[model samples]
Target: MKRIALLMVLALSLYSCDTDDDGPNLNFTIAEITGTDLPEYFEIGESYDLEVTYELPNACHQFSNFSVNPYVDEETDSTFVIEIAALISYDANITDCTEEGELTDSRTIRDLRVSSEDYNNYQFKLLTGEDENGEAEFLIIDVPVGEPEPETPEENTNA
Candidate 1:
């Protein structure tokens, strides 16, 4: 009797599920990167803050997250290509997203650790909007990797 009751409840629950349609529909949109703040060079084994600036497509759009991917060039032994993009999400229900000619500035910082594996230089490709031909554009930045410098002790003023 208990087994039959459990099976009946499960069947009812499956039939009454509105899981497919929640309420507001959300979609992921890629934001164009405008600028970046970083050091001229990165010290291996040290972490540095990389600031990025991007523009939202519309007022309804929001900052979702960051997507970064790395690709190694076959022609170069130590060159690495890093692509960075800002992911924005907006609800499809909001139809008043017509804030044209103006953009909302958004900034995000990421802690990038310099690794020895990325030997020579890091070619950062910041994602920008596509052109008239639908070709994607990127703001390329190259940062060289430096060897670890010797630590120096500070002199005590109390002496």
Candidate 2:
């Protein structure tokens, strides 16, 4: 009877250990846009680099791939709007689940260009997943053709 009981316990242990493991849950969070040296207003025909600072759930999470999708809307001769969709992927390997501490990653925007046009504003949608249903954030900014000129006062004429 003791031998049968021991065999049953061993079988249960083996069965429990055989259960499938999906993987570690890795995620990304955008901390901030660190730099791109972008001016307050963008100039036409000028190229700019966009840098972003992001945070990972832990050190085990590593970036795998990223992409940006732009949709041009309200097209005109000199002005238009572009809605940007950004996606980031992470290495979800379960084998290397290490220290549980926050990790930061920096990345630059690639293959994105701004052309001279009538568009003065842009919107960005940062997606956290491949599907359209995951977490998302929006960022909007204005693009100006040239540097803004300082206003001049005509006080001398009144005096």
Candidate 3:
């Protein structure tokens, strides 16, 4: 019983010491259309909530609050687009998205469009203190969400 108690205390201490600043951070937001399961289109001068995620290497400090801007690009008209931008740490800017870092800071971005062949694709990138190649960054998998078509009587026969 005494040994178990000691182990529990040690575990708690390690878990409590986890924090954010001790490593790199990550954050991003995705928006989908309001109805009919479509890609969320961005209009001129519109407001949208950007979901953000913050990752830390050391797990000693808490993640920071989100700072995302919902901006649109007028240069492209064939489809609606949304621009996601945020500042991440250098540690989070390693060759692999999961590299451990004690300190970091950089700009992360995602460019999406409503009417493109790859409309559901995300352009993930990380820009750190300088401009150079071999920079730390990783791209997330493409995710698509659409309404399921109603099954007809013939399709339901399997059930």
Note the Cα lDDT for every prediction shown: 0.82, 0.54, 0.36
TM-score of 1: 0.72
- Order of quality (lDDT): 1, 2, 3
Instruction: State, as a TM-score between 0 and 1, how close model 2 is to the true structure.
Output: 0.52
**In model 3, which regions exceed 4 Å deviation?**
1-52, 78-81, 85-159
lDDT of 1 by residue, 1-159 (tens): 999999999999998985777588998989989989868778778887787889887777888888999888678869888889888898987778765545656565556777776568888999997899988799999887874466798988997
Identify the leading candidate in terms of TM-score: 1
- Worst 10-residue stretch by lDDT in candidate 1? 99-108
Model 2 lDDT on a 0 to 1 scale: 0.54
Q: Model 2, 1: alpha-carbon shift in Å?
A: 48
What lDDT does candidate 1 reach at residue 67? 90
Better of 1 and 3 by TM-score: 1
> What's the lDDT for residue 115 in model 1?
73
Better of 1 and 3 by lDDT: 1
lDDT of 3 by residue, 1-159 (tens): 999999999999999887746454444322111111123333333333333333334333333433333333345333223333333233344445543444333222233333334232322222122226744343222223233346665655555
In candidate 2, stretches whose alpha carbon ends up further than 4 angstroms from where it belongs are 1-37, 74-96, 100-102, 126-135, 151-159
List model 2 lDDT by residue over 1-159, tens digit each. 999999999999999897577765565533322223335776667777765555565566555544555555644434444433323445555656666765666676754566746566544444432336653444555455567678887678655
